[model samples]
Target chain A: MKGFSKLLKKDLILILNNYFLYVTLFFAIFFILLVNFVIPEDTSIEQSVYVLSEYEEGNKLIDYFKEQELSIRTLDSREELMQYMVNDFNSIGFILVDNQNVEYVLQGYENEKTKNLLALNIENMFQEFTNQIDIKTTYLVENNTVQKIPFNKSIVPLFLVMEPALIGLFLIATMVFSEKEEGTIKAYAVTPGRMSSFLVSKVVLLIILGFISLFLVALTTVGTKANYLYLAAITLTGSIMGSGIGLLLSSFFDNISKSMIWIIIIAMVLSLPFASYFAPNFSPALIKSIPSYSMMFAYKEALFPTGNSSIIGNTCILTFIIGIVTLILANLNIKRSL
Target chain B: MIKVNGLYHSYSNDDNYAVKNASFQIEKGEIFGFLGPSGAGKSTAQKILTGLLIMQQGDYTIDGKFVDFKKRDYFNKIGVSFEHPNVYKKLTGLENLEFHSGMYDVKTEDPMNLLRMVGLEEAAGKKASDYSKGMLQRLVFARAMINNPEIWFLDEPTSGLDPTTASRIKDIIKRKKEDGTTVFLTTHNMYIADELCDKVAFINEGEINIIDTPKNLKLKYGKKLVTVEYYDNDRIVNNTFSIVDEAERTKLNEIINKGNIATMHSQEATLEQIFIKVTGRGLE
Candidate 1:
């Protein structure tokens, strides 16, 4: 344990002294800030409906659309509503013909699903207007309360998972390659220090950096209200897995530049988790096979606690198992190469 | 402090052995040199001894224990300075020593003192990446001594240094010898083997041809003759005389007594010549 601590300290110092680590950190933080502040939030929803009406009940329909969290565009003329619907393929346009009639306008490229949803919404609005039935009263009574999260806030967890994973991958690769190039890795082979200690030291440093980046990201984007413990757990697991991958890949290359090309390639492949993040329903089984998929799923559950511990629990277990296996493989490769 | 018998090793991809049935031993406080050109099993033997390579078919012991490359404690008693400068380039010279010293369980020597011994005290704070080849070599030497190890394994210790630095390193090896540290030096430089080694093993093609002290090997392989240069009749002339024969000695003595001799010296073969003569191949 003492030897491990000493090695950990030395490696930490080396990592701190390396300029590339700071550069990677800067880019990670820059990307987080860019996502949070610079890039535009994805406010366009597929359920956007534009209403143009001369009737006095049009305000009530617009209020219902607003309550449903749909993008509502109001215009005074039917031409303006038609123009809006034509430009936005996923949008539906409604023009009031009389107190009892309404006309629906949709683009030619709109899919069947969009047309069906638009028809259902129009029928429900006509039913409410004609019969004066209060459907929301029953919904409000049963649900009691509803929680809404902003698009920017909901996507924060994905960045938290992604940024640290990237940082760990690049940071460990850079450190390992630098040591290999200088032949200091072979020096470790002849020392009293165990190979396990060396690998653990690198992993510990990566996890520490991983947590720091996660904290800054969470604090800046999500604020103190976010669950810090869950963020830490998910980030730590992701970082360990990332470091293991980095070590395994780095063992095959003698320099950073060579390893970097593979890092980019593997990173793109491992980015299957992003599909699981943005389009959870459309995610394929291949995406779930990726190690980070479990991590990203767990992060999502942690970000918005579903009270169903089974998914998060299973994801945590799988991530850890994969982490341990990769770590063992990495250790073997490092021992052989060194 | 070290012994090996019938040592053999071969890489998996190659059919031939790298060190085939090689054998040697070293006593305490003695400098033993494995003298050979590159690819002549000098490094392979050194690697086996230093625990970098596993001993596959050999009986070997160090400090009275069976050699085991898998044991971490074995490294506590040994120090290796590779031919290449293996110090961390990003670390300051002092930091590199300190970092490596922390690996051993034993009490280490002061890193600053080791730096001073290697004539690198002033540059101890500088990163190794900015150092010259000679400076890096000296720093590697300093790092090897950080643990005050009992056995020193040096591979081409003076290969890439100026004469002054190489002499300083040689002097340090001598001092270590006087301090009762067993030294296993590997080099192709015959001058180093001839000057510092108490005994040298001439190796070629994964086998040792001979092992003996430098003086004894030279005497056994060198010609027993003396060359005399004399100023005769206002012109310089030279003649070789067999030192073993009385008539040739008398003729050489008569020329010397007549005050016609300019210079007279015995012809002695060098270690390189003896290496080629014994192994049937030049060191190169």
Candidate 2:
């Protein structure tokens, strides 16, 4: 522990020199504006349903769709429906050749399950001569009628997952890569400094930075509505885990450029749960298995208490265990290789 | 004081070794030069001694005790100046030294004093990243002595430095040696080894070929000779004569007596020549 404080101080200076604080502040401001102004207060991923009809009853279907408040667009012909569907990855189209026959035009990437669901929904919608989606909808937070987080505020969980919880993955890698490039790791090797102290300093610096980012974005977006104490515990554990992964990754590769492929691959894989965050019903077992999946929901629970305090405690415990394991593995790898 | 016996190391972790049965000793204040070309395992031996590489098969001891690099106190007693300059570039030269000084538990030399010794007093406030290569090399040399180590490991300490700066670094090393610091200097530069090392070890292909003082090695492997340069009929003529051979010694004496002799000097085989003579290969 003799040089641990100096090592931590050195890491802090290096990170700041890399403009990490400025970049983090920029992200904080951007997220604040996004939650407060850009993303609407009452928004959802309600896919637009475009309708194309050759029959006269199509005009009646539009009115029916409008009355039900289904997000629908009317196309003049089948060509237009195909054009729109081809261009819009998120939208589905219904082409009605006659009153009895309706074909679904989908963007090619939709899987079999989604195509079948869309077919069934189309069938159920137009069984009574309707042209588009006719599923009964309920607005949970419209006009604050239900006890629910607003759509814009609900995005806080995903932001927390991406920023404080996982930013350390790349930041720590960058920090370690910088030291390697400078050849200071070799200098560090000869000193009386402990490897555990050196590794711990990096993790500690990231945890501190994570807290700063968390407070900046969370306070600006969620404010007192969130349980700050719980957020701190969860973010601390998440940051430790992120830094551990970064350290383990850095141990194998000499520099960031050499390790960049894996860095991006891991980053993209870890961010996969963000899709599930916005699309709750889209959770497959794979998405749910990601730690961030539970981390996102944990952030949500901390922001908006649903009497599920167990979520916060469970995530913190699980994350702490993962953080400790990865740190141990990283330490061993670094000692053996670096 | 240090002793290394039967040290062996291999990168492949197999029969092929980088260093084999390397052995040497340096008494207190003695400068031991590990001289070899690239891939000759001089670096591997130095790294093992410095604890950057673990001691795999060796009896490497300091004083009367065995060195355990894992023990923190072992590092406190030693310092290393790497071949390539490696300092915290974001920090000022002074700050870099200060940070390194803090790593040791022992009383350390003042950062400013060490910098001053290396003629980097003015650049003390400049970030290491902004330093030129020679300036960075000087800073690394300064940082190494910050701990006031008893055992110092210096790898090509003046490799990239200009003559004046390299001289300054050499002067500092001599001063450290004078202060009773045992120095392990690793280099392929034979002139440096000849000028500074009290004893030199010539290694090649992972095997140590010979170890002795530069004078003794030169005497043992090289013929005694003297080079004579003289002005004759408005032209300069150079001739080398062996001092040991009766006929060549008489010729050398005649050249010395000749008043027109512009320069007359005794010459011995350089460490580089002796290395090649012993190892049957050039250092480069």
Candidate 3:
């Protein structure tokens, strides 16, 4: 027990003294601010003219918008409206009113939230206006609901995939390679303690570190929309697999630079496919091969609670893969010569 | 007691054997020195004895049992100080000793005493990275005593230390020997060997070139011819003389009576000079 404690204490102190906690906090706050302030602002207002149409019977879209307590103003001409749209509205674009129909125009220059909110508000007005009359205007959104994830909610997937890999690889890779370079590990090869105990101590320490990092990243970024218990389980499993991979790499490479290169390559390769916004369609075969993709998938499903079966498949695959890899690496690493 | 016979190990098939058919016995309470230059399989032999490296063709035993290199249980009976300082740089000197001490599953003594023994008591709280080369080497030597084992394997234990510190460490090793613990030391420093070892083996290129007491080696390889100076007819003269038997002694006595003999001394050799002569190579 003391042997394990000594190993854990050494690894934890190494992580703490390196200011990894500060780095994680910095990234968490930066991610939240990036989603909140930087990602949801409009850059242009050339098409901010919004129009509401009157129904055939009586009610106009403006009256319905007014009834819904929305704040919108109407102008006479497109050029005259451009000033109102630019000055009065901080949105991307607007709607144009024609006889019995309404058109929503976006100049493709506003933030994502502004574009999405304008469309949602215009549709809500039409539904409200149609309800006022005796006409039944069907809603396409009622039939098919595209998930409108808020900017705050969108960064959760990125955190889910990046946290375990970055924290695990950085901490474990540095600690193990440092030990190797210092010859402490080679010394342990002749010690009476089991090598597995050394590895297990590292895994346990890293899992705790992973959870702390997850807690920080989550409290600052994903806590509101995230399920803490589910994230805990996913992060714990992901950290275990990550520690195993780190030990495996450490077993093979004695040089710190080479181990770091391998760690960065592995982190980038795994995190690239699950980056939902940037590379969403990275081949399904590749996605299935990565361990973090399943974690990301499970976390997303757990966040949304959309009853997606991919969550079940992802969880099962993640647990099994972690189990298999941990076993294999633990077995192989103990027998490996330094 | 430690016995190693017919030990053969090669890093790879293409590489030459690091330890080939090496055999030796370390009796209890004796300081046995393995004298060899670098790349002469001294460390390899130490590693094999300490259970760090496995041998393919060896039947070695510590306290009369075959060693299982994989399990490392034999480490309980022996302690090793590597040629390189292998302490954790991130840990304090005390913490380094404490951590390694925990690896032994037994009631252990205080690590501070060991630190004090090695003159690291004041620096115990300092991180190993901040330690000088001599300080780190002392800490490494301190770590080797944490287990209080019956046998000690020290590989170039005083390599990087200053003379005073090295002698202090050697003094501690001598105290351990006084406690009846077997000490197997590997060093190229013949002066240290001559001062400490009861018996020493000179190894070169994976083979034992010579093994004997430092005094016995000097005697066996020393020059038999003695140089003598005598005053004959008031003129100084020097002559070579051999002391093989009583007849030579009589001849020398007759010459001494006939003339005044000045100075006489035996032509003895240093261990280093004898090592060079035996192996056809210098220690360097």
Candidate 4:
């Protein structure tokens, strides 16, 4: 254990002395800030609805659309509404015929499904307007505070997961290649230091750096809402898994540049969770097969739990198992390469 | 302090043996030189003895204990300086020594003292990457002595250094020998072997051709005669006389008495010549 600590200290010093660690940290913070501030957040599905009428009923209809969180744009005439609809593909035009009826106009290029959905919603609004019935009903609103997370905050875990995992892979590759190029790895073979200690030290350093990166991203984006303990656990698991992958791939190459191609390939595999995040409905079982998928999912649940303990528990278990298997494989490969 | 009997090693199952039927022994405190050109099993043998390579077939013991290369304890009493500069480039010289010294349980000499011994005390705080080639070699030598091991395995310890630094390294090796450290010096430079080794072995093609003291090998293979150069007319003339012949000895004396001798030298073979004669190959 003492030897392991010494090795870890030496590696940490190496990492801190090099600019790679600082550059990675800078990029992590920059990305988090960019995601939070630079990119506009889409809070809700807001579509502009143009109301072409000057009547009191038309005003009521505009109020109703506004209540539904739609942006209401009032036009002066039918010709203006048609011109606006032709020019703006994303906006729907509402032509009020009388107090009892209305016409919904969509652009020619708009999808049929979106056009139908818009027509149906307008029909319901006209029904509520003519009948003067309070049709607005709230369900499951008591003690079920469904906090609407911003797009930036919702995707923070994706970046956090990717940063540590990819950095872990890059770190191990550079470390192994550096020692191999210098012939210091062979020097260690002649010393009293065990291969296990050397490998463990590298993994531990990755875990530490992984935790720091996770903390920084979480703090900057999610703030106190993120479950720190769960974030740390998943980060450690991802780091171990990443280090294992890096070590395994680095053994095949004699230098870091050669190993970078494999690192990128493995990174693409690990980044499958991002695809699953952005397109949840399109997720395949293969994406879930990726180790980072479980970590990312578990992290998301920890940030916003829906009371599904079993899924999180299973993800944690699966991640832990994968981490262990990869770690063992990495140790074996490192020993053999040395 | 070291012994090997019929040691053999092959890098792979289908490859030829890198060290074939190689065997030798060294007593305590003796600087035993394994002299051979590159790819002649000198490094393979040193690697086996230093616990870097495991012997496939044979028995070897160091300090009366059989070593298993896979065991961590096998390196407790072994020190090795490889032919290349293997120190961590990012680490200061002091830190490199301290880190490696922490790996062993033995009491290590102060890192600063080791640097001082190598005339690198002022550069102890500099990163090894910034060191010159000679300075890096000195640092490697200092690192090898950190544990003060019973057996020292050095490979081409002075390959990339000025003569002054090389002499300093040789002196340190001699001092280690005086301190009872068995030095297993491996180099293709026969001059270094002749100058420092108590016993030297000539190896080529994964086999040892001869093992004896440098002086004994030279005497056994060299011509037992002296050559005399004198000023004859306007040019120099040379004469050879056998040291063991009575009339030849008188002729040498007469040349000296004539007092016009420009140069005279005994025709003793150098270790390089002796290596060529024994192995039918040049050291280079």
Task: Sort by DockQ, best first.
Answer: 1, 4, 3, 2
Compare the candidates by lDDT and give the number of the best one: 2
Question: Number of the top candidate by TM-score?
Answer: 4
lDDT of 3 by residue, A122-212 (tens): 6775675667656568884554544666656665666756766656766676777777778888777767877787788777876786676
DockQ, cand. 1: 0.77
Instruction: Residues A8-105, candidate 4: write the lDDT tens digits.
Output: 88998899887657966887789877877886677565566778875766777777767877668888888898887778777777787777667777
lDDT-wise, the better of 1 and 3 is: 1
**1 against 4, candidate with superior TM-score:** 4
User: In angstroms, how far off is A36's CA in candidate 4?
Assistant: 2.4
lDDT at B36, model 2: 92
Stretches of candidate 4 off by over 4 Å are A43-45, A52-90, A99-101, A104-121, A124-142, B230-237, B253-263
Of 1 and 4, the candidate ahead on lDDT is: 4
Candidate 1 chain A worst ten-residue window by lDDT: A137-146
Per-residue alpha-carbon lDDT of model 2 for B45-77, expressed as tens digits? Answer: 988887777777989887879988878888888
Model 4: docking quality category: medium
Instruction: Please state every model's RMSD to the true fold in angstroms.
Output: 3.7, 7.8, 5.5, 3.2
Candidate 2 off by > 4 Å: A44-146, B229-241, B246-261
DockQ of each: 0.77, 0.51, 0.60, 0.67
Residue B42 displacement in candidate 3 (angstroms): 1.2
- Backbone clashes in model 4, listed as residue pairs: none
Compute the interface RMSD for candidate 2.
1.4
> Model 4 over residues B103-198: C-alpha lDDT tens digits?
887778899999999999999999999999999988988899988988899999998999998999989998899999999999999889999999
lDDT of 1 by residue, B91-173 (tens): 89998998888899999999999999999999999998899999999898888888887889999999889999899999999
lDDT of 1: 0.82
**Candidate 1 C-alpha error for residue A275, in Å:** 0.9
